[model samples]
Target: MELRFIEINNLVLHEYTEKIRFQKLITKIEEEGVQKSPIIVTKIDNYYLVLDGAHRYTCLKALKYKYILCQIINSEEYYIDTWQHTISKDDYANHIQILLKNERFSKLDSEKDKDILQINTMNDENTPEPLESYIQFVDCLNKCNSFKRVHKNEYSKDSVKVIYPEVDEELIKLLVNKNRRIPAGISKVNLKCGRILGVSIPLQILNENTFHDIYIDKIMNNIRKYEETIYLYEGMIL
Candidate 1:
């Protein structure tokens, strides 16, 4: 994996971030003075499209950091998946009611399962832009009593599950090209061999204008220092 610092402006975010989460990250980075992990990105034409860590990217940019560390990966090596959303029963009903009033959304006939609902855009004038639809959905979702993104649909009488159509890389790139973004916590990127974490590069180092070579040396040293601790694991990590 390639890890290096690049200009923050060189990156593009494909997902809308949570304001609260972004603030929290800024606070954490300020207190710690180190970036715990590099944001993941894939080069698309002339720009680097963020595949993960949208919150981190925005937080650092908000902090006025000119350079941010990133992990560059191949665009063809990853697949995108959508999260299954669950919310409290009352909130779910309220959300559905809200969608019905908005012409942008169309509620499809659900599966045999009563607790699960399928929702999508109607392709009409009322339909907001691709990014806005996700933003609206997230706004409505956050107002719910209890909302969670799940991998498996666990039937719960107190909660209801909602599913949207899967999105592919082409769609993601298209959204980015159009200056749009999917909402946070919905699009999931599955990368082979997982991601590198806990590198803890200090913020000061990132700000140095002449630290590229030194940064590479430090990274090589870090690789040696952590070699014993790194191991490959198959299956899901909770």
Candidate 2:
């Protein structure tokens, strides 16, 4: 539950970012003039690897902010899951033809294969790197007619589902260490407790010039303001 403003350069991403979403976030944050929540991270050795809010981290970096607020969680306090991507039938039909013969993936031939594109089977030196292959796969889907992430598939006639493998902290650290990243919006991290949200911190005070005094003052003020604001909610977050 520790929250503090750390230098942006000290933060590292575990996944590749989507450029279109990154650009949109930059515009949205500029218009709002306040960040709704701090990006979540876990300390790993010398770097704080981002667990969530990849786009937010990149947006602040793009805006030339030297330090960004982060919600620091213990590395062992969270688990990771994978998002299931769905694409239009038309796009799937078109791409499946190309993928069926692709070397990097295997066709979903059995019921045990999980009914999704098997994209993690790079076996030899000649094969494209795992990160590069994943980026290419998602980029093609992005250019398609329709794409979305779904929690449950409706078994619709027009939708094609793609389930990817879930990642763990070990693999995440390996990727960061090698300067590689998976496609964004796939690694879903579930934390043990409630996250700090809706703080609405002003963007103007996050600059380098104000990092020493004004930033700390505002953070303390916000902490005092929300010290007694906690409440219990029993409902599901979906």
Candidate 3:
């Protein structure tokens, strides 16, 4: 129960028994970036133990993070076994612009206004939902498989020029990486921890033109789904 600044790399961990998957984490990693949660300490002595954070440790190891926040505790006294543990997912993202672009927000007098101002105004009957459009984009991106050009699925999404052209390959990959590939059954839920923007991006531009509703809807849906899922699945759902 003590808070100590231990060298994250120094801690020794028990065999990672928890089934931590990468696709499950890709959503938060992309939106929140990295540094989502503190490492779990399961086996601790005068120096170290395996508490949690098996997946996070792996991610840091893969990303080569030099330092991390680890739980400092004793393994002998409170020797309890659990399937999964919950952690924070608040990503301290400095570049909020990536999440909240200038067009995503607007100043109505003084207070900031989110909620896109109806991207599709003219349609008397069939204007697509903004959230739905964002979802479609996520679907399309999943089809691309991150633009790595794999065999068997070599076709490109050039037809989606209106919403997502070839230039937005990276953004598409990010969306798919976040939501589409998540697997179930997790014990700990960690929120992304990093700098965050003061406000959300203005997204009226997505509504300003013809098919912007679909574009904005898809992106927002991914972000919303990501945040909600992170909040809900931090402990048991995985």
Candidate 4:
């Protein structure tokens, strides 16, 4: 029952403890520095196993992060219960999303620290895009980044129409919600397509059908218009 701080690649993971708060960790790494905290693992003769902090190992590897600090314990006697939790990537990401927004973690203020361990809270104008918008597109980016797939399969209903490779499905829904089809002289109903897309299209020259359809080209165009968005493009499973 000795506590020894150690750092090693995943030689052994308790066969559990997979879903770790990844976004927060990555943000802390990206903001404060990569070596914020070490993980705790169990070590035997030649290989070390994980008792806790499996997410740390998996995420770092996924991000191609080379090194991490870990605490290597020397026995199985310490764990009263084997790490019996099972979590998927989606679950882990969702959990991390919550942690990233948590008040406790949000108040860390790493900017003042010389060592800069973690940016638990940051007020940057550009941060992660809303989960609702980015989730679907994240899938596509992850695939593209992994060189797995360049585009996505079309939805059954929209088979004839091309679904833009990088357009987030949820974002489309959001835009649809924001743009109402209110017919009248009311100001609220004037949420035009050109304005939402941040482009200029003269109303006089444009026909009535122009703003009615939400197409993939328009989505791609909007993304290009907001080229400086911070997290709208993090790669995922699409």
Winning candidate number (TM-score) = 1
What TM-score number comes out for model 4? 0.29
RMSD of 2: 5.6
Stretches of candidate 4 off by over 4 Å are 1-7, 16-20, 82-238
RMSD of each: 5.2, 5.6, 24.5, 28.0
Query: 1-238 in candidate 1: lDDT tens per residue?
Result: 7887889999998777877888888998899898777899988888898888888889888888888888899966788888887777678787655776776677767568565565675444353444355546656765775767766856665666766656766666667776766666878888864576757777877677588667756775766334344665644577
Cα lDDT, model 2, residue 192: 73
lDDT of all predictions? 0.73, 0.70, 0.34, 0.34
Please give the range of 10 consecutive residues that has the lowest summed lDDT in model 3: 115-124
lDDT of each residue in 1-238, candidate 3, tens digit only = 3333345566543333324475456445446554543455533224354345566665555555455444444434333321221111111122111322324322222112322111111111233332333443333333332222122222222211111221122222333334332112212223233212121222222113444345335433544222442332437663
lDDT of 4 by residue, 1-238 (tens): 1222233443444222213456666665446434433455554445565444555565555555434444445432342221111223343344333444543223233233232212222223254544332333223223221111112221222111111212222333342344311111101111111112222222221123334233324434454334453343445658
What value of lDDT does candidate 1 attain over all alpha carbons? 0.73
Candidate 1 lDDT at 227 equals: 35
How many clashes in each candidate?
Answer: 0, 0, 49, 9
What TM-score does each of the candidates earn?
0.73, 0.68, 0.31, 0.29
Residue 219 of candidate 1: its Cα lDDT?
70
- Give the per-residue Cα lDDT of candidate 1 at 86: 75
Q: Which ten-residue region of model 2 has the weakest summed lDDT?
A: 115-124
What would you estimate as the lDDT of candidate 4? 0.34
**Which runs of model 1 end up more than 4 angstroms from their true locations?**
87-108, 120-147, 156-160, 224-238
